[model samples]
Target chain A: MKQDSESIQKMMIILSKGTLENVYAAFVLANGARMEGINADVFFTFFGLEAIHKKKLEHLHVATVGNPAMHIPTMIGGLPGMEALATSMMKKEMEKIDMPDILEFLEILTASGVKLWACKLAMDMFHYKKEDLYEGVEDIITVGDFYNKSQGPGTHILFI
Target chain B: MERTIAGNTISLNEEGYMTNFSQWTEEVGKELATEAEINMTPRHWEVIKYLQKEHQDQVALSIRRIGKSGVVDIKEFYQLFPLAPLKTATKIAGIPKPASCI
Candidate 1:
C-alpha cells in the first residue's frame, strides 16, 4: 500500500522579485502543484515585494512600454481605413482569454491556502512596515527562517 | 476547449492573459447570474481589459516602449461600474470567495 500525500512528498518555492510574469508563474505552478497534493511556499523579497505592497499590488504594471510583446496589439493599434474594424477585432479577441489580474492572482493563492512569506531584512532595508504589506501575508521571516522551512527531502526552492 | 463567441470562435491558449479567467469566467458568470439573479458590469470588463493588454505586454512590452503602466484604483472602479444590489460585482469581478464563505 502507498502512503498518502500527507505522509510524503513536499514541494516549496521562493519568490524574490515581484514581476507580473514571475509572480504569475510561481502561483500558477504552486496552484497546479497543490491541486496535485504537493506543498508550495513562495518567498517574496526585493522588487518582488511590489506584489505584497497593499497599496501597490492593485497597481502593479506590466512591462508594456519597452517589452516586445506590447508591439503586437499596437501593430494593429492604428491601421488606415481598417482601424475601426481592427479595433473591433482586438476587443473581440480579448474576451476569449482567462487571465487573472495581479491582485486577483494573490487572492486566489491565499484563498487556496498556499503559504506566502516576506523577507524581514529586505523589508527593513526598504523601511517597509508590516502594515504596508498586503492582506493575508502568513509571516515575515529572515533568510534563515526561510531556509528552515526549505529543509527536508523533496523541498523545492525557486526565485521567481 | 474552443468556444464560440459573438460572431467568431475564440481559441483558448495556455499563454494568454486572464487565460484561466477568460476561459472559465463566462460560464461561472452565467451560473452565478442564474443562482444570484445578477448581470455582469463594465468594470468587470475593464479589469479584464487591463489584464489582456498586460498579458500581451508580458510577451515583450515594457513601460518605456509601451508608454503606459499601473492599474486603475479598485474604488473608482465601483463608481464607473455600479454593482448589482445583491453584491453581484464581486462575482463578476472574479473576486475570490471570501475565506469565511469557504
Candidate 2:
C-alpha cells in the first residue's frame, strides 16, 4: 500500500534510572510521541529498576538533593527549611500541570502500546525476578541488545 | 491578513463536546489551543488533523520485537508534527500514559 504523504517517525528511549525524575521524564516523552502518533519504547535498568518494581514503582519519589530546580522555593522564601518547602513545592508544580502520578502515567502509556523493559543484569544483581516486575514489562536485555533495537536510522534514543 | 467571525454563533448542550463551530466562541478555540498546547494556528490545525488520523489507523508497524505483546511503534511523528506536544498534550487530551514509560 502507498504510504500517506505524511507519517510520524519511530523512536526508542532507554531509561537507566527508575527514580520519579527519570521515569516521569521517559513517560512524558513517550506520551508526547504517542500524541503525535510516533512509536516509543523505554528500556529500564540500574537504579532505574525501582520504577518498574511492583512494590516500589508507585512510590518512586523524586531526588530532592542536588536536583537543579529543587532550589525554587529557597529562592522565593529565603534559605530556611528549603528542603521541606521544596518537596511541597514540587508536588504543587506537578498538579498545576496535572501530570498523573507515577502509576497512572504508566497505566496510560502501557495501554497505548509503549514497550516497557527490565534489564536482565540489573534484575539478577538486585535479586529481582520476573515476578518482581509489574504487569507490562518486556524482557530485560543488556546494553548491546537494547542498542540493536534502537539502531534504526529513524530511531530516537533518550537516556532518562 | 484577518478573517471576521461572519456573524455566526454555535450552541452546545450540557456536555462540553462541541455542538457546533458556528456557535463556538474564540474562547473555545483558545481553550482547545491551551489544552492541546498548540498555538491553534492554521499551521497547527493541519498537523493536529494528521495526528488524529494516524492515531486512528491500524496499519502494520516495523518495530523490533520486544515485549511478549510486541509493542507497536506508531512512528512518523516528530518530522510530520513539529509543534506537537509530547508530555503536555497527553494531559489535555485525557489519554492514559504509555506502559513502557510506566
Candidate 3:
C-alpha cells in the first residue's frame, strides 16, 4: 500500500436541509476541501434541492424556530417575517466576512471544479426539471450511482 | 526557521511559508515555485505580482476576491496553479497562506 493511503483523497458531501446555515455549511466544507487539493462533490437531496433551485436559492432563510442557536423563543421565531429578518442580518454578517452570496457562490464552486449532483428521487418528488436547477449542477443521479462514483479508498461520504 | 534560497537566508514558518515578505524577489520566487513543482512563466508571474500587490495593500485574499481581481478569473487561476491554487500561489508569491475557506 502507498504510505499516504490514510490521507483523505476526496469528500462526498450530502446536503438534505434547505436552511441557509446548513446550505452554507455544506458549501464551505466542499469548497474548503477543494482549497486543500482534495476532490469534493456535493449531493443535494430533499429540501436541499432548494439550494440549486434558481428561483429559490437567493431566497433561502436561516431556520429560527427549532434552532436553539438563534437564542430566540420558539414562538417569537415563528412569527411572520422573523426568518427573513434573521436571514438578512446573517447575510450582512456573511458579506462582511467576504462570504459570497448564493448565486455567486454556486458560480465559484463550479469554477473551482467541485462537481454538484442532485438526487434523482428528490427531483421526482419535487417535480423539478433539469432546467429548474442552477446551470452549474452536473446532473441528477441515483443513490446507487453516487456510491459508484464514490469508489476507491480514502473517499469519504458526509451527510449534512 | 531560517533557510537559504537563492543564496540568501530567509525565515519561514512551520508550513514553509516565508515569514518576511521583504526577503522575497523574483529569484526567490522562482526557487519557491520549483520547490512546489511549478514552472514560472509570464502568466504565473502576473498572478504572483497580483498576489504580492494584494498582500502589500492588506487585502485579505480569497478565491472569491481573486476571481473578481480581473487579473485572473477563478478558472484561469486554477489552470495557472492547479491543486490548491490559493495555497500554492500564495506560497510561491512568498505571502502567508490565506485563511479563507472559500
Candidate 4:
C-alpha cells in the first residue's frame, strides 16, 4: 500500500533497551524527525522501560555484559561498582560534548513535540506504577495499541 | 570555494554552505538559490529570512519550528524547497546547516 503526499506524516521509534546510549540515540532521532516537520513518537518496552522510570532515569548505565566494546569478560560486568563506574564515565563523556543528561534530554524531546509511550506489558512485568514513570509519558499502552496508533501512510517505524 | 555575487565574495564550505553569515545579502541568496536550481520567490525569501534571524539568535531551526514561527506553513515550506528542505533552505539562506539536520 502507498500513501499520497498528505498521508505521510508520522515517524515511530521503538526503544526496547534501557542502555544510556540507546535512549540518547532515540531522542536524538526523534528530535530530528520532529524538527523536520514530521510527527515523532517513541515507545518504551522491555528493558527500555527503565528509561522512563523516575528514579532509574537519572542513573542509567551502559550494559557492559554482551557489549562488544567492553572487551572484559561478561561475568565481570556483574561485579559491584562496575556499572556505577561505567555510568559515571559515560556521563562525563557526554558532558564534554555538551550533551544533556537523560532527564534533560527527555524534557527537550517532549518540549519539541515528540510523544513518549510506555508499554503496558513491560510495565506490569517490571511491577511499575504510573506514578513511577517520568513526566512526559503520554500513556501506558500495549504493543497492539502501538501498532494501531502507528498505522497510516508514510509511517516509519524503527526498532532501536 | 567562493562565489562572488554583486561585488561581494561569499565563502562556502566544501559542501557549499555559507561560512560567513555577515556576507549574506538578498543578491547572494538569489545566486545560491539559482545554483541549487530553485526559483527564488517571495515565499522562499520568507523562509530564508526567518532562518537567518534564527541563526543569529543561535536557535536550533527545524521545519516544525519554522512552520510554527508563522513565516510559512510546513507544506508550503516543503513545496518551495522540495528536496531536503532544511538543508537546501539553510544553504540558500546563507546560514549554517541546522544542528538537527546534521
Q: Find the candidate with the highest lDDT and give its number.
A: 3
TM-score of chain B of 4: 0.90
**Lowest-sum lDDT 10-residue window in model 3 chain B:** B75-84
Q: For each of the candidates, give the backbone clash count.
A: 29, 24, 0, 0
User: What tens digits encode model 4's per-residue C-alpha lDDT throughout B1-102?
Assistant: 887886899898998898998998888888889987799988888888888889889888765466568787655766787656788899998898876531
Could you tell me which 10 consecutive residues in candidate 4 chain A have the lowest summed lDDT?
A1-10
Encode model 3's per-residue lDDT on A79-125: one tens digit a residue.
99999999999999999999999899999999999999999999999
Off by over 4 Å in 2: A1-8, A72-89, B1-20, B23-102
Candidate 4 chain B, poorest ten consecutive residues by summed lDDT: B61-70
lDDT at B29, model 4: 87
Error of 2 at B55 (Å): 20
**Model 1 regions lying over 4 Å from their true place:** A1-8, A65-96, B1-102
Model 3 TM-score is 0.97
Encode model 1's per-residue lDDT on A22-101: one tens digit a residue: 66677777655543345667888887888888987765434433345546455443345344454345435533444455
User: Relative to the unseen true structure, what is the C-alpha lDDT of residue A98 in candidate 4, on a scale of 0 to 100?
Assistant: 57
lDDT of 4 by residue, A1-160 (tens): 1236665478899999888889888887886775565778999999888999998988788887888697768899888888888888888987766577788778767755678999999999999999999988999998899999998778989999
lDDT of 3 by residue, B24-94 (tens): 98999999999888888899999999999999999999999999999999988888888799999999999
Which of 1 and 3 is the better model by TM-score? 3
Worst 10 residues of 3 chain A by lDDT: A1-10
lDDT, model 1? 0.54
Query: How many Å off is the CA of B30 in candidate 4?
Result: 12
The candidate that wins on DockQ is 3
Global lDDT of each model? 0.54, 0.56, 0.94, 0.82
